[model samples]
Target chain A: MAHEHDPPLDPVFKSSLRELKWIIVIWLVHFVWVLGYCSTYGYLTPETPLITVIGMPSWVFWGVFVPWIAATLVSSWFALTQIEDHALPDASPLPEKSEADEKGGADHE
Target chain B: MNEGSTAALLTFAGYTISVFALAILSNRVGKGKDFVGEYFLGSRSFGVWAFALTFAATNASGGSFTGFPALIYTHGWTLALWIAAYMVMPLVSMALIGKRMNQIARKTNALTIPEVLRARFESPAVGLVATSLLIFFMFFYLLAQFKAGGIILSTLFADEPLFQSAVSFVSQTTVNIPWVNQAEPDYLVCLIIFAAAVIIYVVYGGFRAVVWTDVMQGIVMFVGVILMLGMALWQVGGLDNATRKLEQMIPPEHGSAILSTGTVVATDQTFAKGTWLFDTGKVFRLGELAIIREGQSSTVPVKILKITTPFEVEGLNAKRISGQIPDPGLTVRVTDPKPYKYGAGQTGNYVRNPGPDSGNDVGFLAIGTAISFFIFWPFAATGQPSNMVRLLSFKDTRTLRYSIVTVAIYYSIIYFALIIIFCCARVLMPGMEIAPDQTMPAFAAQLTRDAGIPWLAGLLVAAPFAAVMSSVDSFLLVVSSAVVRDIYQQHVDRQAPEKMIKILSYSVTVIVGVLAVLCVLNPPQYLQDLIVFATGGLAACFLIPMVLSLYWPRMTANATIAAMLGGTGMHLGLTCWGYIADKEFRAYSFLGVNPFIWDLIGSLVIALIVIAVGPKPNRDLVLKFFHDTTSDGS
Candidate 1:
């Protein structure tokens, strides 16, 4: 439980905000990467030869398929390595086992 | 039932029974915990597997399985860009507020989003408003899920004699009922069965059951997609071959036509909807069954197809294709065959950026719409109350961290694999546009049969079925919580007895589930559209307010309420304007951007302005939410 006299902006809250900034940055980067590449090369002229990379069209391979793989890696790194884990505050204990609490099968299987 | 249908039905029945068993086990697990918290929040304890799968499964609803595949099959490769934003959905949706909100909920011991808000501000009004908005949006969401469930079942059992008899009985029984009679007989029969099964399991099992089944369903979805991908790739030869075929393929044209049986004395042959037709070496698909009874004509819709590519034609011809063949003595004519407005008689459109559209010239996913979807997927996910509830249940931050990465990888695989599998579906099963939403299941049966294991179709169809069930259970629980915890317990009787609360919870779940089914008896036309509307509405109502409440210590109750109302008003107002303009249930996009973007902007601006003008939050509230109050003795 936080107190009135304690200083504002605890370590947990500050770290959360910092993590939020990084997450937003990641979102923006991927958004631009996918949109820019896809929109630029997705529309093609009939005379232009259809380019294939691996199995997918060059634009789709680079724009969506590849970025999707990269995103998984980047997100994994961020979640596992960058973000900090803090203990959550425990829930306030229930009233010392009222008669209703003592009799528990009301919510049946 | 045919051998294939029997196998599929048995597999589906086994899956459903497994789900019920999990529900029973979950109920047993709830024996000793606090009744309200255990049933509603799973005692706020979820490990990585449970948390990750539930979050992913709930988010990947019936739309992901049915609507997404349909779009890919209809529009071609552009859906890749349309849904590309999913790459960052995990980090953005989970990392943004998962930690902060979880911490807040723990401190307050809040079991619901509305409860969290009410406790944060000490305002009953806030809780009431939140509850009202949640139930409103989620009710519509539940309706869409029910409809999806019915549709999947109907498609699975279309060839079953027992199922056909049940449909006939249902149709005859409800023929006089105004709304019920309007629904398709198969859909109506399946809807009742789906509704009964879901309501019983969810009401009995509670949140833990929902989570347990979600884990199983999630795995089913993943395995189903991987298998389908393997079969599709194998059947289509390889990815390179499929893409090459797509490049040469031309988009089909849809139009209305009148089919006439000649005046000759010949028996009338019937052409079923979704069956292939041959006319002048060009292939066509019947949009509706044309039964020419005794020298009469039937006006029906048809899709004109041009499959000149010898490679695809060979595959089609190898199947010993079955379609109606008119007698040589009978004269037949098709009138008013409309050509595609865009990309008519053109090749290579399927592999291009915007892809091809039957109606729109700029393509199915224009630049503006593409950008809108890029923003829509991740951020919209963040604002969902169902996702928020899952975030609150993790055992610890480590679980959260691991779950985020798991979901990111999970979505990347499922989405990318689906796009590949369905794109290959175009080559294997051409002319699915007659019933596009059935593409996933229909293609699954076809692929499995081709692989000489028709029984596997059951497991594949269960993927979409599981998706619908997972979503339905979560939404059902959410609505029940809102009613029982937020409304009845908090406002009606804060000290309601445990037995009463339990009974009320069960009753509410059943009632809400039944109401949603009844509402969907005459189902909506587009599943994806309804999902978009409900999700967008909820995000609009809760996202900004909840985010500000968690981060800004000075955020006032007045501002939170204002932001919620303003966002809801903006979203609905724009949707209404869209309906009037287009005469359809779609949102009006200003400047080509979706209504969600504008609604979110308006919501943020409103919240900030209100926070600036309104008085600060109560000092005690700030200390409770923000400061380290453990050090300062109250």
Candidate 2:
């Protein structure tokens, strides 16, 4: 538990935040690709020949299913290989941040 | 009783019996565990398989099996895209918080979401506010689950011998009182039975019992849903045929079914006596035609009696399909009905059919709505109090990894499989104009009957029933814990004895269950809508505060309070406004976003801004949540 006054932030904790940023970025890009490219909504009207991939709609095959399969794989990778299982090192005092850094409070920076 | 009803009733009974046995078994096995911890959090002792299955079952409600499929049935191929967001739901929900949640939970011994928030911020009011909001929305969710159970039971046995005999017994034995008939709403009997079964097992077993039951039900639902999916494909020959069958291009008259009985039982869509039913290959649902009288306008209110049946029709590639329900059944009952046709196509270019929410012609609105929905529902699953309860009980980080894989695989199969099943259903059972929520049971019935194994239908019916029960039991526990652990024990009586706490926990669970059942007694038709709003409401309320509290160390108690109460009030206030102002508020979007998106966006923005500019929190509060140690480093 944190006391009234604590030591400087741990480097491991800061890196985890950095890792969180990268993960969110990767997933957000994937989300856009699935929605904008895979799904043919608003572009293909009802009159268009329903293109099929592996006997399913092209949008569903390429968009929803393919993208999700990738997502699941990536999620597994993150959970297994990427994330640090051990808790961050105890909050021992470290080199002090500059005045500007302290005011900014963006520790992950 | 007939074979179908008997099979259904027996399957349901078997499921209930298993639940009771599991509850008893868990209670017996829990000798060494602390009562409060064991009853509420399963002593924080769940393995990978247990964690994965319980998490999945708790999250996937009856809505997934029933209401979701109906949307697929109503909308054509586009429904798949509408739900594509789910592919990332498990990942987003578990990954960001997976490690932190498990570590911090053990560190603080927080039993509930409210407890976690309270300890993290060192503010009792945060706990109170969060608990109040969870209880408020979760009650509606619980009510929807109970009502969904009732609907599934009633619909599955509506024409079955067992249901008929039970109704007959009641109607014959009881006197007919004015206004309140003994056998009216016929769904009430099924509702009561379902409620009692759920309450008994949930109260008896507690968290361990719930998780154990979830594992069984999850497996049953997984296999049962897959079976229905396979049967649906087989009924339509293959996925290629299923898609082409729905893709057949026909004239506007093709939209209306050409009913041909000896006499036209329904006049709305019936054409001549000899020609084929409109020669339209595109059929999405079963058609219901009102039998009109002389000088009676189609617009005026009148009695509507339905007679629908699915029969073979030749479509593209000269294929025979049975899903086009063409002929009306009650021609003999109508008075002098003649073959007639009117009100052909409403949309001339409705070619590749769109799902209910997704429009055929993708536009800005469609893309925006899709984006909003993708974010909304997935966040709901991740941020739900019910799901959080399971996450808190996980034994270790390895369990989290296993849960992620399981959840991803599980949702991928179930969501995609449902789309296939209902799409095939469109080919095999179109013109079914019942309540949209009946899509699961209706499709399950056709899929099983077509497979020549009526018994499988019994188990398939149990799948959705299990789906609802899993969600209900979990939510019930969360609400009860919020009251007993977060509010009563924390605030009202901090010195409460352990014995008293155990009793209170059990009692609170019972009281909440009974109240939810009472809410379902006079069930409304739009319970699905209520469930959606409740889910969205939960996401709006908790997603912002919970995430920020963990990640943003600067988030003060004031910000947490603002986010919880303000977010909830914004959603509830807007929803009530929509209900009062426009009856069909779901159809209207705020600015360009759906109500859920708008609510979530508003709450999240407020939380972010407030944390950036709000009052500085106590040093201990931030240190406790963010730091691992203090000056006395040992």
Candidate 3:
């Protein structure tokens, strides 16, 4: 707990873990929501005429295409904003300025 | 050789030689490095496009190019729904594992999935078990790819000079052995040639070569599918007209009345359950094979004006349409999936039974089956070790983020485009072949003939051929690496020299490639079945432990071992029992779903319960595992 020369560190790992859970939950919700629409909304009966999209059934369009757009947006948004790139906990403890880059990983600036 | 066939063969040769050149160049580039990292992981330096295309190409496999098209051709439009899960697949799989796996691999220099798991869990046993399971399922998966390669080559080149000569030479010189199918001269020759090409390129260039070739293959795959789609639709007139003609093939008043398809034509012929409703318009003369394509554009009947002949129902005449029959102005408007068969001499029509076995023999005619299919793929996708290899090989999180988006978009366009093209193929090539697996090549061949562009046939064959190679190369590496790196190096000889590892890597790649081909010489079933069985086993074994270990800190070594071994055992037991009990090919049905689901869910439950009841895991170990790579303390 007492490594010197680095700014006093507040561990964000626990909160990040919490944030990860929330992200997972949001992803799951989107999955369930899409499946729900597919099974519930698009599962049409014979008497009902299916609207065609791109020359396919309306239900299929909603089931696959709509969620495709939504998923693209949702995933990209999550990747951009929610995923904060952090250094892994330094397996080696060193002065803040001289944190060792194990194997000098090329990713480290 | 015909000029067109000669041209096509030359084009194929050029593509293969170019791929070999890339591999040779990459081998030079990859010289002087640790064999394990340089060979298997490419020293973990792939930029955005390399990573994205390789990842996509690896997953696209022969199934994507061949089997999927077959399903769409045979079963109809529901394939659009079946493969829809792919749109969210990259998000489900990549978003969860990509950044974390890359971070951890860089931190620990973990070169393989087992290496990653072993490091993450701090348990050699976990690594061993995972590696064993990977090798096992990868065999089945790899064999399927080989089978696909053989099938593609045989179908596309059946009329070629080399193939015909080889077949004649083999049959004339050889006697039929009890276990061997001496009849399949073309399949054996293609399998050997395909296997040789893949192993040589992969063994020489290692991961770098694989990735470079994957880039080429990925582009070929996209172009091939798009051009095939355009050609198929063009041959059938247009999308609007194609779907229109396809609708007419249906007997009006079943349940599939989607796409503004046709209402039934008032027929002068009403044959009962004995046979199909033939020539609903009563226009074709005797001895003419008339095809009844379902209509999507209007109420008028669209029938193919050709027929071969089937006198099977001559004695069972129920009732020919007398002068005045009601139009039944109401057309069935729902597009229900069903398997139908009609051709020369076959008087039967594809029927839709809303009761039981609705939508022909495609049992997934109901809502639940559709949803279940959607769920299986994404779930199985996450558990594949080859995919994990891709996840761990990315250069950075930024690369990962971009690849995820790119793959999602790529799959969406490619899979949907395939559905349209294959659906249209059903119209252009009516009753083309009985076996669904033959449809893609059949369609491609038909396209080449009709368009009079023989070189296009080379491109079409190359697409699936590329998919198979992309999948097989990665799998060969994964299987061989598990033996060399995880087993021999990690456990057998920690101090094994780099030279020995390099030699072992290359030789093991060849041996594994050779073994996969031999197993399929007596292949029990179709390539699709083999792929599914292997995928199920792999997912059942790895999905829970791998995904859970990533996020959950409390996961203990005991849980990992139990999940790894126990899950694999459970899948084996269930599949074995299912196989022994059922006469049908879909032998692994645990509670009406593919055994993968039950096995995965069952395995996860077992794992969680084991963790719940076991001793409190070492908090320090847990912290150490999670701490170093994922978060910064400051």
The recovered share of true contacts, given per candidate in order, is 0.61, 0.25, 0.14
Determine which window of 10 residues in candidate 3 chain B has minimal summed lDDT: B346-355
Q: Which candidate is the best by TM-score?
A: 1
Using alpha carbons, what is the TM-score of model 1? 0.94
Of the candidates numbered 1 and 3, which has the greater DockQ value?
A: 1
Candidate 3 regions off by >4 Å? A1-34, A40-50, A87-109, B172-183, B251-362, B585-594, B628-634
Which CAPRI level is candidate 2? incorrect
For residues B1-634, write the lDDT of model 2, one tens digit per residue.
Answer: 5676678878888888999999999888776767777888888888888889998898888888887777776666667777878887887777666566655566667788987777666666777788888898888888988888888888777767767778677556544643234335556667777888877877777899999999998998899889888788877899988777666512121123322234422334332222122224422222343333333322222222122212322332133245333433322222222211221222212123233222233321266767776776567776788887787788766777778888889988888888888878777764443355677777777677767777777899889989988988898888899899888876687767778988898788888888877667665667767777788888888887887877777777778888877777778777777777677433236676777766766787777777677667666555555665543541
By DockQ, is 1 or 2 better? 1
Model 2 bad stretches (over 4 Å) = A1-19, A39-42, A87-109, B159-162, B169-185, B249-365, B585-588, B630-634
Backbone-clash count (model 3):
31
**iRMSD computed for candidate 2:** 9.1
Q: Give the poorly placed runs of model 1, Cα more than 4 Å off.
A: A1-8, A93-109, B176-178, B264-269, B297-334, B524-528, B632-634
Q: What's the distance in Å from true for residue B312, model 1?
A: 4.6
Question: Between candidates 2 and 3, which one is better according to TM-score?
Answer: 2
**Top DockQ: which candidate number?**
1
